[model samples]
Target chain A: MEPIAVISIFVLAVFVGFEVVSKVSSTLHTPLMSGANAIHGVILVGAIIVADHSSTNLELGLAVAAIVLATINMVGGFVVTDRMLEMFKGKK
Target chain B: MSRTLYDLIGLAAGVAFILALKGLSHPKTARRGNMIGAFGATLATIVVFFFVVAPKTGVAHALPLHHLGWILGAMAVGLAIGVPAARKVQMTQMPQLVALFNGVGGGAAALVAIVEYLHLGSGATKAEVIFTVFTVIVGCVSFSGSIITFMKLQELMTTRPVIFPAGRFIIAATLVSVIGVGGWVVAALGTTPLLILAGLSLLFGVLFVLPVGGADVPIVISLLNAFTGLTVAASGYVLDSVLLIIAGTLVGASGTILTRLMAEAMGRSLFGTLFGAFTAKPQAATGAAEERPVRSGSPDDVAILLNYARRVVIVPGFGLAVAQAQHTVRELADLMISKGIDVAYGIHPVAGRMPGHMNVLLAEANVPYDQLEEMDEINPTFSQTDVAIVIGANDVVNPAAENTPGCPIYGMPILQVANAANVIFLKRSMRPGFAGIENELLYDPKTMLLFGDAKASLTKVVSALKAL
Candidate 1:
């Protein structure tokens, strides 16, 4: 939880991201992008955390909206990516 | 749940996220990779709910069920909208669909930050306030920018760049005010300034993308995708969640790299795309008037050419998607192949708005993967090709990129379809492509223009070949 430790982890993750993602062929770039889009939908966890702990009605309302948006982002992102990948057939 | 158990779940989710990215690196494993990623997302969501919220233990000293109903209701709403859209959307609209999904994610991050800021109630640590404010600004920009892109792609608005005389001045002023108000919110901890910051950021997003032409949308959308990732990362910093930090950083870094690659493919840099005043470059006088006559043909003529050709290459573009001609083109290829002619498709790296967009369309039409050749691989064989068929494609095959200096797309790699003995173009008009520039390849004596709807033209050609 130390700032230095967190920053270090972030820096390492950046290299890992570039390393893993750069290997994707240009032909798969769209799906790669869509898949990355889904991964960031992990922010839905943040929305749920805020919504659950919300004290006031206004804060609760905003958090619930956030949850809905994030959920759509997550579900739609993954499903669309799957649909795209399914169409990627091998040489017949 | 104990703190140790919570951290354990986060760790497992992080590993799953990495595996998901790994799976996506190759087509053979991409579908399974997506499933693994989705599983990780579900696990992370459930873990946060149970480990952080539902438990009676730990730091949360208040009621947990107050907004539970609203949260579930919102989730149902997301499913209602997202599942069907993902299921039924035609493949042609994939770019806008991705943009819309990206917008929602961004809006969610911004909203989450706002709620957290309110909950802090002026007593939060400086780091927390700073991170939360960062999320609010970036997320709002990504959200609004993505929606504008969606509208353009969907044709609710013009796909052409909307530039005005004082556009740059207005954008500069709005950006300055956004930063000023954002600084005020951080120093004073006032919700009012924060609200103003969000509004200005949304406006800034609209202005930011308005001047960019359609040819640049893929890079803009990819960059916005990275922005959403950074927003999520900032929210993670606000919440001090390690899993969120790792996952967000991964997307942020990868999206940035992809954006750079897309830009390079178009021979433009990210700096130019953002700040360059790309007001509609005039449509060049195509030299069609001075040049030797361009051969024009009917569908029957094209059918006869294909029927006699020993080898053929098909280059597809966004026009193919617009005309929904993939299936018809596939039938034509099949007919040619049945006559013992070799047929191959040339795929440009940044073709058809999104990466691999043409390949996905071709796959839908049951075009074999091996027959889909990349630009580098197919360019060399064009000289040996008896007939090069360009279906609704122009910019990618344009010779201007290699031959003409001062042209916008100069020095960019292009398909060498011009090298073929005979080139057949299926086009709607003499109007330029998404890049808003004329293609010199159209005027080549060896090129024959087949002007009509791509599907109707291909269908006619198919029938003509059948009659033969």
Candidate 2:
């Protein structure tokens, strides 16, 4: 991808992000934070790539550790956010 | 598998992520929203692994899979640790746990960038090198800053602002050096400079968070979350993945807005919070603390007060969380309802450690959603209320926020519980709140202090109400 194209996507996503979460009720703020926290675990994709491509044993070890950390972040974040959202949903 | 097909899957997952955020804007669809997000993430993971990276054909073959077992094994280990911890972490500890989880994501991003840099080894494009360095810097900072936040929240370190002479200057110097090294990395695409850049970035993270007072930790956490997001997006740029770009930017932007909201709630500028020294405690007169008289009340007295009150408001704060008193507070409110006394809860946005933290705790104890009134809605009714019961709340009810000039928390919004006809404060001592500022509202003529553990006090009050 061209640098210009990537920058354009980044710009558009920023606007979308700022717009999407404008008026979240206070009660949902923690859930929203945790939920957004989960999304950044998309870096796990990067980790998987790193693990697959490494040559040296030392690099491989680091990549494996990265993969595990990213997975924990992804799984824990989504599940915990779901647990919190469950409480919110049950409130009604 | 066709590469275009994989990109389509990634695009679909990005759309799912959007729907997830939309769902969370309202409570009605939030649970389903979370499920949709989790699904999107899973789909993206599967596509990236099997179709995009795992194939030993095409340009992707350069980043070849060395061992299949390590990847699968790491995921298994992750699931083993993550699932149970997420399941069992107490509600009171959620803030720190979230910080810890955010740190792990940051660590992963940094590690991914490091390994990728090693693999690419100067053969990468200028754009790729730039993004990888960007990811390394932000990822390392987020990782370290989040751990410090976790430690502060967990009480493993002092919550007070830790500052030395010329701290801001040191932070500035560190940042400048990091930028210099970053420029070097981008120009030369060298691996050796990357490590030093990461190390300095990590140091900057520590220095950045060290002087922030405890009251602003949530804002810091939110800001760090955004930092992590930007790192993930930079990682996406390095990997040429659109899903990571979309998802990371979404988090970065939303987290930025949330941080702004949090700082606004406290009536402080983001710049002030980042660089300003926070010491809210009022200076003592003559270096000798004079004893101020406060009316002491027992459970029976509080019950008697509640029995005849026409309208009651319950104010809950972090102290309530610390004492695990949500369920008992609910019992007391239920008893008040049975007697036909109008009752509602007043929640300050910053009442607990994180935004909406008190609401989560109360909801878990089965408190109805409608009964938990926001600060704006409940503040007006406090003046007409017959009694305002403050359960382990101090700072949020302190009138100094609105009335006193030169006070550190001045201009910040607070629940006007002091305006009620009568106010009962359940506290452990005369000590100040998390901000380390004295709440002069305790000395208000109509106020009475009921000192004890919030849970035990509320339980006794419940029993007394039952006996009545």
Q: Which has the greatest DockQ?
A: 2
Candidate 1 lDDT over residue span B1-468, tens digit each: 776888788878888888888889888888899999999999998777566543212265444445668878888998888889999998989999999999999999999999988887676778888888789889999999999999988879877678887888899999899888888888999889889889999999999998777767888899999999988888887776888898899899989988887787667778877754553354457566445556789999998888889999999998998999988888888889999999999999867877778888788888888888998899889889999999888888888779876665666688999889999999988777876677767778888999989999999999999999
List where candidate 1 sits over 4 angstroms from the true fold.
A89-92, B53-58, B62-65, B278-295, B404-408
Error of model 1, residue B433, in angstroms? 1.8
TM-score of chain B of each: 0.93, 0.94
lDDT of 2 by residue, B165-207 (tens): 7776898999999999999999877778988998998998899
CA shift of B83, model 2, Å: 1.2
lDDT (C-alpha) at residue A17 in model 1: 81
DockQ of each: 0.75, 0.77
Query: Candidate 2, residue A45: CA error in Å?
Result: 0.9
Candidate 1: pairs in clash: none
Location of the lowest summed lDDT over 10 successive residues in candidate 2 chain B: B55-64
Model 1 lDDT per residue over A7-64, tens place? 9978998988888877667888889889999889889988988887677888999998
